[model samples]
Target chain A: MALDKRFIGREYGPFVYTIGAEKLREFTLAIGGAVPGAGTPGEPLPHVSPLLHDAQAAKAGPYGDVIAFPSFAVVFAIRPFSAALSDPEMGIDIQRVVHGEQELEFLDVMRPGDVMTSTGRIADIYEKARMGFVVVTTESRNQHGKVVVTGTWTGVVRG
Target chain B: MPRTFQTGDTFTHVRECDRYRPIYYAGASGDFNPIHIDPEAAKAVGLGGNILQGLCTLGWAVEAVGVFVGDPGRVRRVRVRFSKPVRPEDTITFQGKVTAIQDGRLTAEISATNQRGEDVLKGAVVEASLE
Candidate 1:
């Protein structure tokens, strides 16, 4: 099925996610990263943080106690992605679907245990050559609406 | 005082995923797409082998940049284009270097290549100082 162009610019939903530190460790370990120690200046660091690095500030996630992996922010807005892609009205075929690209921007560091929400939107829909490109952007923020991260996914639909 | 920066300096790291690495990332990320996890599922279509998830490969490139910047928050922007899929038995390398520096922001051109030197992802990133 070809991607539904009508869904372009339509915001799907606000998906909530509760991230943890252990899951970060699991990802790092699985990817062959060693647990990192601390972020002290001039000190060599590990792949996983022993404790939250920016824990001093008044943070929303996890009381700023648990640490977050470097790439952990990707999941912050994934639930909204699930909802957007699974919409029946969208004709995205799960098989022919291939992830073409991803760009993530971190505005602020989010620690584990932070309660946050991800708002998703179909940012762009276009057809180039014989393939279709669907770009989806999701924004994750704290209860206070402080932007934590922005994740954009570009999927290529080849029929 | 902050250290002087130049655009000519760069870093590159080469790596390859094991036969099982892709599936592990999929499980962790809760993206149970069979194209990346199941070899047979991939072959049923037109893929030569089970391809790595673009996110997993992105995570790897992110790891490379994360180490270079020394802080997770230092990364301001990252753009990646998956030119080809990364198979399990293939070795991939990430090559990147500073492309531009302006007003405390640094831009980098990055790419991941398989064992056959097939470009997996062509991308760029902009990083900023955390201080």
Candidate 2:
């Protein structure tokens, strides 16, 4: 079955989530940020590598506190797509879906304790070679109504 | 302290995706797609085995860019197209170069490859402000 083109521009929830410091810490560690010398040897250094074991440095760092990692925006921004894709009318085959690409732009730094409201939109939906491609663009705004991050996710669903 | 970046400057960053990384990322990012956390489920779908979340790999890329810029928030834009599945135990190396410096912004082209030199993410671009 082909994805309905009418679903393009479909909008989903303005879900709200408050960032937490502990969550930020956990994400850093889960990716092995908690240990030193874990990355590929030499050259480019991991950003969070410095703060993995030292909490004090992270406090005085650029963002001035425990800030979410740049890609951490996915935590809050990805929820609405669940509701959007699963909508009965959309009829997206979830089982065969695969993430094809991702784009993230950070407009303002996101700090822990900042409540964020995110809205999801179906930016595009098309069919190619019996495959369905859907793009979801999610915009997250801080409590002050300032746009903090925008994430564009492209999913390829096999036909 | 911000350092000036010149065109042609290069840097490389490497990260390892442990066997349990997908589960951890799924927990943190709320993406429980079985392909990431279920090896058998992934094989059932012809994936051979579980794969790492594409966004997680992107996270590592952005982290590399942030490390180069010296400020995490300075990363204004990051984009990547996933070209291959990153499997557990794979080490991804991100090699980037400053392609242009203009109007106080530095632009770089980055490419990530796994242990076998397979391009996992390609056509990656990052733009950040001069620190």
Tell me, by lDDT, which candidate is best.
2
Per-residue accuracy of model 1 over A52-74 as CA lDDT, tens digit each: 34344324433345455546777
- Stretches of candidate 1 off by over 4 Å are A33-66, B1-4
Best by TM-score: 2
**Per-model i-RMS:** 3.4, 2.7
B125 in model 1: Cα distance from truth in Å? 2.4
Give the distance in Å from residue A135's predicted Cα in candidate 2 to where it truly belongs. Answer: 1.1
State how far residue A10 of model 1 sits from its true place (Å).
1.8
Docking class of 1: acceptable
The residue-level lDDT of candidate 2 at A118 comes to 95
Deviating ranges (above 4 Å) for candidate 2: A32-55
Instruction: Write down the lDDT of every candidate, Cα atoms only.
Output: 0.68, 0.80
**Tens digits of lDDT, candidate 1, B18-114:** 7777766775677778888888888887786688888777776766665565544566777788888888877878877877888777777787788
